[model samples]
Target: MTFVTKIRLQSGNRPALDRIVDEIRSTAERKGAELRGPHSAPPERLSVPQYKSTAGDEHRQFRSWDYTVYTREMEIVGHNELARQVTEFDFPDGVHVEAELKQVEQMA
Candidate 1:
């Protein structure tokens, strides 16, 4: 059987985020896991205060990210460690991080 883990991390620090992405990729490789998606794909969401707006109406911007990682059931490890490191890792000024983890099992 194969298993996968979906991880979501939020960091105001862009440099830290960049480094962790690489570290996670390396960790997954050492643990014989497959990581999908981009190392850093930035998606911005635009929202306006009023539902109806005309031309030249400015809106708020929100940023989010998406990533997919794969790993075998028995060979899985260090996800929490990475998350911990990410949380505590220091970066340039005005930076912070939050992480979320989800485990999934493939149906046989």
Candidate 2:
């Protein structure tokens, strides 16, 4: 049986996101882990409406705050140690991480 760890990272800060991804990539390279990629996804543009007061008034609303979120995804293949390390990484504030583990059984 083989396991695959899929890691997805998203943040509004591009530099910080890239830095973490680079760190993971370097560590995998040094440890000779089979890493799929740090593939980048298109920036997601989002907006939030600002309200001056809790009352629902159209005139009391402010301009929408717009932001872009960047995402990077990678997969660790058959290296449980490396995958665990990545999942347990101490990511800084504002960076969001999601990890999923899947078991793959070879057809014999």
Candidate 3:
């Protein structure tokens, strides 16, 4: 059986996100882990309505707070140690990470 670790990272801070990804890539390279891509996804633009007061007032609303979210995804193939390191990495503020582990069984 083999394990695959898929990591998804998202942040509004592009520089911070890229930095983390680069660090992971370097670590994987040093450890001789099979890494598949820091694949980039299209930036998602999002907006949130800002309210002046807690009270529900249609007129008392500020301009929409808009931001773009960037996402990067990578996979570590059969390198459980490297995957664990990545998942346990202490990312900076505003960066979100999601890791999924899947088991692959060979068919004889």
Candidate 4:
């Protein structure tokens, strides 16, 4: 039996996200674990309009706030301990990580 760990990392701070991904990749390589990739996904763009009141033309001069969220994914195969450590690893502020583990049975 082998465990497959799927990791998803996202952050508004691109530099921080890239740094975390690099660290995970290096750690997996040092452990000689089967690593898949740090695949990048299209960034999510969000916009919000800032206004003091819902309906007020007297002072309705406002700007739209924009933010971009970057995302990356990686897969660890047959490395339960390593995966656990990664999931428990402390990440920097503005970076978010989500990990999922699945058990697979080998077929002869």
Q: Best TM-score goes to which candidate?
A: 2
Could you say which candidate leads in lDDT? 3
Q: For model 4, how does the per-residue alpha-carbon lDDT over 1-108 read when each residue is reduced to its tens digit?
A: 988999999999999999999999999999999999899999999997788787755468478789999999999999788999899888999998898888989997
Residue pairs in clash, model 1 = none
RMSD of each: 9.2, 0.9, 1.0, 2.3
**What is the alpha-carbon RMSD of candidate 2 to the true structure?**
0.9
User: Candidate 1, residues 1-108: lDDT per residue as tens digits?
Assistant: 333344444455555555655665676677555555433445334333442335533463233343332211112333555445434645444433334455565566
Off by over 4 Å in 3: none
Ranking by TM-score: 2, 3, 4, 1
Per-prediction TM-score: 0.40, 0.95, 0.95, 0.88
In Å, residue 13's CA in model 4 sits off its true spot by 0.5
What is the TM-score (0 to 1) of candidate 4?
0.88
lDDT of each: 0.45, 0.94, 0.96, 0.91
- Candidate 2, residues 16-87: lDDT per residue as tens digits? 999999999999999999999889999999999988998867789999999999999999999899999988
Off by over 4 Å in 2: none
